[model samples]
Target: MNPSHSHPLRIGVFDSGFGGLTVLRALLRELPQAEFLYFGDTARLPYGAKSRETIARYAVSAAEFLVRQGAEYLVIACNTASALALDDLRAALDIPVLGVVETGANAAQAHSHSGDVLVIATAATVESHAYATACAERNLRAVEKACPLLVPLVEEGWIDHPVTREVLSIYFTELMHQSKAAALAPDTLLLGCTHYPLLREPIEQAIPAQIRVIDSAEVTAAQVAAAVHAPQAGTPAAPRFFATDSPAKFQRLGSRFLGQPIEHVELIDLEALEAL
Candidate 1:
């Protein structure tokens, strides 16, 4: 069932770090009337490098914290959590849950006539092969590549720097070669990491013109909007922001991803939440 438009909705967005802000930014556009609670597990970030068991524990703790804050729905905005711990979050939370990986795969199925897609994501996400599994379930062939360097580049605020562009060029060139080697005619290039959306312009320039770049963040927001039937216009209050560590850093870096000035961010202790 879709979220009712008649009453204000409380939506929770969780990410390993600032990258998930891109999804929140899109959600703001799609669901202007809904109040948002965004939690970034900055202290335990890059969930990408952790074990699945560990990722699940951290994700569940974060999700529970948001639910405690009255979240009616949860959006797992981190690709690593979505890849490794989505089922854990769903099992642990009573609220409806959506993950970027599924939305992205669904989009690939809908948009790709050739039924072939390319995914570039962090090492953990690629290791899990979630996108490949999801696409194959939809009868689509997928080639996944680990673009580990991109995340650090994004966090370093070098989005459009020439060095970043050259890195993209190298990554895409290798990815295209892999696609060809797999004998797949891929028409859809999925930005498997939320951080990649920030580099969209350069990514588009780096890849071949014929291949469509899918911003997973955009597709996830559209899917949520469609599911909820969110109202078209309402002056949404600024989202309540929570960070596990370094609220100052989050506030400083988050606006770039959110596309708006973050007036404030609150520091929350996850361990303290778990005690409650």
Candidate 2:
């Protein structure tokens, strides 16, 4: 589809939880002229640990919900859901569906000349080898690490707190140790989880200065911009926010990710997805 002809594109972004706000924030910044619909499945969050079948079901439901809400394009911001359910979602939805893993992997490959890349995400994302597959397709090496505790830490707003630092030290130590043992100390590390970006400061402090950290949020935003139709020259587009639950909490936490206060957030009933 010619996105440039589709003015005021209605873009949809979904995550297992609030972490997807990271990607939404980036998109809003990159494409302020585009309209957006954000869906956070806080009712069924932490999809990282779920089974593949379960993740697929959730993804399909989320995509259907967004489509019903009039989304012209869809962005699956959850790494776990993207890794396990993207194909299913594409088959089930008519709109163009994009995922963070592929964008992140491509960014990592482009930034890492050494062919050494580290991916830190949830257990499901790591186990799925999504990053490994993306890198292998380009004949590059990638190390996958799962920092399960980091998501909760970020959600709790402990980005630069002492506890966050302590936990990060432990995770990074293991990641670095694994990389060194494999003789693949990556020059770039992919923050595969949206929540990871919230902890970027602490993560940077824990890792070596020589290593570069890549946030998929920007890459995903660029992809969304490329896929959506550009806005008309004189038209103004406003971003919209939606959540399955806790609009107030989403708005409060969203400000941190969005870098500004969200004017309003609307709550939607995800149950309507069953009909879609």
Provide TM-scores for the models.
0.96, 0.92
Candidate 1 per-residue C-alpha lDDT over 175-245 given as tens digits, one digit per residue, 9 for 90 to 100: 98999999999999999998999999999998888899999999999998887655455666669999999
True-structure RMSD, every candidate: 1.5, 2.0
Show pairs that collide, candidate 1: none
Q: Alpha-carbon error at 24 in model 1, in Å?
A: 0.5
TM-score quality measure for candidate 2: 0.92
Whole-model Cα lDDT per candidate?
Answer: 0.91, 0.84
Cα-based lDDT at residue 61, candidate 2: 88
Off by over 4 Å in 2: 3-7, 272-276
Give me the displacement of residue 134 in model 1, in angstroms. Answer: 0.8
Give residue 94's error in model 1 in angstroms: 1.1
For model 2, residues 1-276, the per-residue Cα lDDT tens digits are 555654577888999877888898899888877778888887677787789999899889878878887888899999989999999999999988999998988788788989899889888899999988988887789989988889778778787799999998998899888998989958999999897887778888899998999999988998777766667454656667777788888888878877778889778777675555
